[model samples]
Target: MNPFELEAAVKAAADGDASAFAQLIEAERTQMLRVAGYYVRNHIDAEDAVQEAICRAFTALPTLREPKYFRTWLTRIVINTSMSLLERSRKTIPTGGAEAEYLTASHKDTDGTLDLLQAVSALPPKVRRVILLKYMHDLRLKDIAELLELPLGTVKTYQNKGLNLLRTYYREEIEERRRAVEPIAADSAAWEGKDMESELSEMLHRSRERAKTLFENQSAVASAELKPFIEDVFRHGDQVRELLFIWTKPGTEIGISVTLSPDGDLIDYSVDMELYTEQEKCLHLPPEELFAIGERFVRDHYPDAPDQFSALEIEDRGDRVFFSCSQYASGMPLPRSGFWIDLHRSGFVTAFKYFGSKPEPVMPDHILTPEELLEEVAKDLSMKLYFMRLHESVHSQGDDRLHLVYMPQPYLINRPAVPESGESKKNAQAKDDYDPCAGANEPILEVLRRNEPGVPADPETLLESLGISEAEYEVLREVDMGSERGVVYRRREAVPAAEAVDSTDPYTLYRYMQARNEETVKVRFDRDSGRISSFIDFREETGILQLDDRACLEIALNLLHTADPFVFPHLRLNLEEEEDKETEQPSRQNAGFNFSVCKDSVPGFSHHVSVSVNRTTGRINHYMSADLGMEELEKLSLVPSLPLEEAKRRLIAALEPRLIWELDYSDDRSGDGHYMLRYKLVERESGLSVRMIEAHTGQIVTDNF
Candidate 1:
């Protein structure tokens, strides 16, 4: 079986073609058994492991991303199965017979060969496996590293350690054998001048040379033997126009490169038993002609190249033309995934390197309409106001103004409710009865009563006492609301009193009291700097009052209109029952509505804002906002390119179902040990992924792109 044929067989097997799968197993049975034998005690155990591996391979064939690597993939499965069996049985497998059959036949001194094999087998499993693969299987260090999924340097260490152990064991065994045949004095005299280390090294070197020679012979035979197989596999046969060379290395693909002469004649050809790089042949050709030649070369050699490869760049360095191309899907180029073909002036391909696997686009069976997708987005739509700083130039100085922007709400995935323990439930009930607003009302009333007859105070002294630096604060204006009189200062040098009060510090206890004609002690702090720049104290009493949820929501909506008209249309009330559970009580709770933007029904790409109104006074309690800069707002596409129905269709077509372990955020108890099935939406070309819809509900679960 050749590489191409093996890949075809793997594909066929993956598609449930039993005959092709059988052929694949038959071709690899010998190698699989040989590798498996190292880990088990006997032929029966080795055979069992190989059989189990074959079953597993057949079952997992569809998951194999690259069919060209069927051999390595199967070999790994065998190794794993064998290791598992070894661990389960907890028995050491002696290598006497297996070693004699595999390694000792090449050596003339059977005793010495057996001693070396014993030493190798005596080493730890990892080291022993490396030695056997390198020497017995005639695999290179690089091949061993890949086969074991270890780093090259780590494999070299194991090889050296194994060799040192073998040398020690061989020397001890040789000394014991010599002593049995001769007297101690005679044996010492006979071995006195001999360097055992040198002898051992020479012996090991000879064994390695034999293995190399055997590999070379095998390679020579494979070149001739595999020619017909390659021709048949490539579907060219004897009429092949280009010279084909099969490059093979231990634990790697038997890659074939086709070389064409300038005049389209068959050039020199040779098969390499290891990875080989050919010297560059300079070709004098125009950039356009070179690009055409490179494209043709790739098409002829790798018929498996992706369908859409855009020209990334064409570098003309006088001597050569390097044309780079990348794979793209839906106009988006895959990151670091493409081929770079370098050509010299002589029309020779200097290098052909591919960075990523070929793209496999899967069209979903059911296409969703844009409207359907929009509906899904609406379910998770959250509205939030973001405070953004807008800068304007007033003469030479820059004036920073705060603005509120409306955007889509982010992840609104339904979290599982946590089951509370008995003690926790009791504590939560107790907390529910604790009225935070009532407690806050008492302090404001006391401050109002004490300062009802507004006393005059120096603004600078007042700011200093409030832990604010004069350099960062400046008195902006003075206001008299009947009983209360106070000066308002800039929250920060950049922010105005009106903007700060309107945006972040809307529901301060003092501000609430001011509206009621109660004690007018008011203070506003810069949200970011923690500096108080606005203070007012009034002597009066404002009785407790409450507002309904409808009134609160109306106030919030009205505020949005005043903040930014552009943001009003995009905002939608998030009326989720579970989300509003905390504010359900009419008397104790301030009515508030969570608003989210459903502007464009794209999952994982939205913004949000929330507003809460005081239950008693119907005053705005909290207004959450985001700072979406002007540049970002300018780029906002109010209308989506695709309709909700169309987006849904594309999503359905591109959905990939898989079992994933996702954190159940809703789970109140620990919230850590839950996983479920999910269908993921992945862009094939770029590998950009998002978990848009759940498998069960077909609803958007995440807004992450």
Candidate 2:
């Protein structure tokens, strides 16, 4: 929507027009939900938060000081609501009505994914929120910090600490499995009691029982450091019970570990594949069936599997074909194999390899995961399974590097209460000075026995309770409407401008800014030929003000300021999808805009289309080309024959960032050699139309016009 449409919508909503408000809501709901979902992992809960946030915004619209910031304001509400819901089930906002209204398809998917979400939901509020924002919602850390009103450093600290714990936990699990295998061969005499097949069966039974017991008695057996990861990791272990217990044929646990960047990149990860058996197990898979099962498993579970992970090497070693599946992805905590019809065996899984950036410099394991070492040193800090680690550049922080740990509250709505005796004493602690309602008639405190229970009643309530009829209340409310009557304006007349300026009146004095000299050039809109623009203007012939540009700007700003914020907010966004094996990052080309005002009239949204000094940029950019109007060629340049590119070149000037230059020939040069300059080029590229911008003036220096 353009500024005028936005202004109109805001004005209508401010006047209680709910339909106008809907457009604003529709435009922002997706962004609100995305941010809200991160806070409230529970789909239904997030939906509830958005609804309530919108509803609250509707009523609060009247109080907004800046409507242009509606987007950010609503986001703040959504973020706060998510945190409130996560930390305490008791909602921060009354959203009961909104929850039912905003339900969508995603809200229903929450049920089946509960098994997977177990680990995620177990995280503390702060940690879990960070993870949700980073992965689930794919928000940048900088935005997360701004939305949550937190310092950037603090958010980064939480992210690093959280992911480190998760990585260490998975790594430790692998180490334990390795130790259980004990690389040294088992004693031959240990199988003295029975034949190899029968002995293997007995060992399988024991191993299954042990694994089941660990799964069942984990609440007690798991160490505190790994307990949170364990609970969520296996929270829905029962949901996948058959797969975990019944289809049991494990060598080593298949686990995955993910490393995330502050910018939402899946920077690194490892998938570990292990082959081991309990104290004993049967290797009786006829070579034919085993290979079939392994191949089927890889194909079914990893349909999006990496291409050519490893060359399959099959060698017929007389007794059996050694099928070697090599160099699979390591550090994946999630198992790779799922049930495949061809595999016939649900438990059969094959090793896979990892892709993406090679890990940074061959730092020692401890360097990569210093938080683990810290845990080893400080036994008490165990909350570290929900964050991504990103190194801080020295320019950002003075530290060598910082970790972002997601620290969410593990539970919600459990708070300590005050004692009964202290409750009575609360009234005694009430503030003393400036009680406008002090001993006022009607004792109106009873109406708000909730918000301000022990406090004095408000004056409005006091008057209403004093038998002031509805008719009488309006007069009282309007008594001091125009301005505070306690001062000279008490006579109920418009004060003259002289007194308005001299007086520290209830309203701020108006200061008219000097009007800039009239400047004009032809401007054109390719599509919306009839839309009015928001700009300052002056009549060329009369040399008189055609319109007060400042007043026009103030009107738009005021409408934004007064309009319901939940319905509209200022929003600026930059988002791009990640590069994966199948796809690469695409370069974005930015095309510059050109405009010169025309005498021709244009249609508008609600008002007249006038070509003025408006400088608003276009909405989303689309690739296209257009012929420059003859007038555009002239207004921007008196050289009629000169092409657009050459004309632009003469208009541009170059400059460097943060650099100061002192010309020896300058008569007005200061003693200090300093004048900072910044640069930008106007013409943009969209992979085809190449152009260079004049660094200093941000004008189109050159382009393939």
Candidate 3:
């Protein structure tokens, strides 16, 4: 119905018109059922909740303060009815009233299904109430504050805490499932002759048992000073969890919240912003008055803030003025541990954020002077040429084609590597074999050992090598890649019939068990040629380590030669010295190798093959190689028009040194991090930070507007 008709119907319904009330409520029945389903979870219970809400709304229709809010009023009644029904079904007797038990008497859940409602119901009572009102019922923060008779800040704080708890719960559930499946896959001997369905059912049964006392196990840890603020907030989980203490006047969004660590030490304290009201936030107060208000709030909360912190700068953001403060050590600022207080123009502190921890930084023995920093930046910075396609918006006067351009380097200064003397810095760079342009030479194309086409190999033999049985596996064909075809073999298992049952009783049924993937071996090949392109083993590996980098490379090379013997001589191991210097060594768990087939070593015209092996089994876990035809690579340009020396000169001429403070987070064995003042290079005049440099013309361009 249109707004006018709805308004008229609401008026008539409120004036004791039964027909109008029926018509109005009938129009909203579908929406009411959906909202009810969010709480009650099943269709039957949802319909029952909606019916009960219709009766309650009809009795209280005349009491609604505004006729325009008829839908909202009815929705609130539906939410309450659904919660009441859900509570009764869960065998939890709610306070305030006793009503006719419908589902409680007849419904008996045989399977536990932990849906979204079950997760929310597992939360602390106060937090659960706020989450239901805010999300399930779609109530505004302002409306919720008024209905609950609690501060707006408190509701918002509860909302954030509820979200964090839900995220942690879901993450734990995923990890638990992964742990459950890995044992079944890795230990075949122990699980021999066992039914997979029975094992999964037992795991789910334990999870459901834990869900019964999930809320009671978790307890929030807070200081005595913070206890008064968090008395209404609910706590969950076995370990002490983070608690947020917030206080605000009813109806106003302006309030304060303090976050405390598990040890009751201060993590952060901040004032909540007052955003909903249309009134001007500025009081036209002078800078002195604003500073005083902020200082007072900081001092009252933290008595030692004046002695330990120093005011950094003042920012006037029109609505609120902010006073930035930071901890100082060795006459330099510690950026991480600090507080920022913002005030409304009326000289009242609108927001305050403080960090109380003190960090002990490993102080630099010798600081770099401005001249030394600039000299180091000039020596380290160099231009690298790239071919980039600019967006049409960025190239208003030019066509959208690839352009070559030179961009400056050294955006980040590795503070720990900065030397105390220029001689030491030069020696260190030489010893480490540092190359500024090392990142530009990454392999663009991967090619397999076979360049010549041959007869397709038997898939049965490959499956036997991976310890997979053809009798228990079935092939899945997909044509999503257009020209390329994909074939996946999934292991078959019997699905439990009882698992499909959705039971709403929280105390009786097993919580919802999300679908789990049993490890399936997959192999993909060219459809026409029948030559295998990629193979992956999805099963978990658990055994003694055997293969290292050299062993893995030997296995990869032999596999490539077996696939295509003719092109095996042309493929070269593509590991570069620059790669070793820049990248960390691969872990022992999985060793990877790459081999490339280049056309006269031309950029973007070469193909590479990458193979990764499981160290424990000494078998290839993943094998991937590009299948680009040789005819395609022969069409691209092989050489560049610009010389290397000219590009270098242009890059050096455009470079300008910029000094900055850098933080070093690496542990230097002394258990303290370090900070250094250094210089980096940027574009000279306009300072446009575009990375794309036109190769032939030596001009800078951007891919973004």
Highest-lDDT candidate: 3
Lowest lDDT sum, 10 consecutive residues, model 2, at 228-237
**For model 3, the run of ten residues with the poorest summed lDDT:** 507-516
TM-scores for the candidates: 0.23, 0.19, 0.38
How well is each residue in 424-459 modelled by candidate 1, as lDDT tens digits? 434222211111111112322333344333322344
lDDT of 3 by residue, 1-705 (tens): 433346566755554444457658656765576556545655545655776678557644544544644664575567667665664345221221111111221112212234567878877766777778766664545445545655444565465456556544555454454455444432432233134234333533443333212211212111112211221111111122233344344433234454444344444444333422334443488888778777776776577785677755787666667677776766666644577766667665544556555655555566666456555645665544333333343332235343444443422222232455565444323211222222222222122423343433455565555555677776643433323355556566633232344542221111111111125455655566666666765455566766666676666665665554444444555453332323223334566665645444332211346677777777777765445444444543435456656765665566555544444322222212345554444466655323334556656442121
Among all windows of 10 consecutive residues in model 1, the one with the lowest summed lDDT is 228-237
Q: What is each predicted model's overall lDDT from 0 to 1? A: 0.42, 0.30, 0.48
When sorted by TM-score, best at the front, the candidate numbers are 3, 1, 2
Tell me model 1's lDDT, rounded to 2 decimals: 0.42
Which regions of candidate 3 are displaced past 4 Å?
A: 1-260, 265-335, 339-372, 377-419, 431-538, 542-572, 575-591, 595-609, 615-619, 623-638, 666-672, 684-694, 697-705
Compared with the true structure, model 3 gives a TM-score of 0.38
Candidate 2 at residue 225, lDDT? 22
Task: After superposing candidate 2 on the true structure, give the runs of residues whose Cα lies further than 4 Å from its correct spot.
Answer: 2-4, 90-459, 462-705
lDDT of 2 by residue, 548-577 (tens): 333333322222222211111111111111
Q: Which candidate, 2 or 3, would have the higher lDDT against the true structure?
A: 3
lDDT of 3 at 591: 63
Candidate number with the higher TM-score (1 or 3): 3
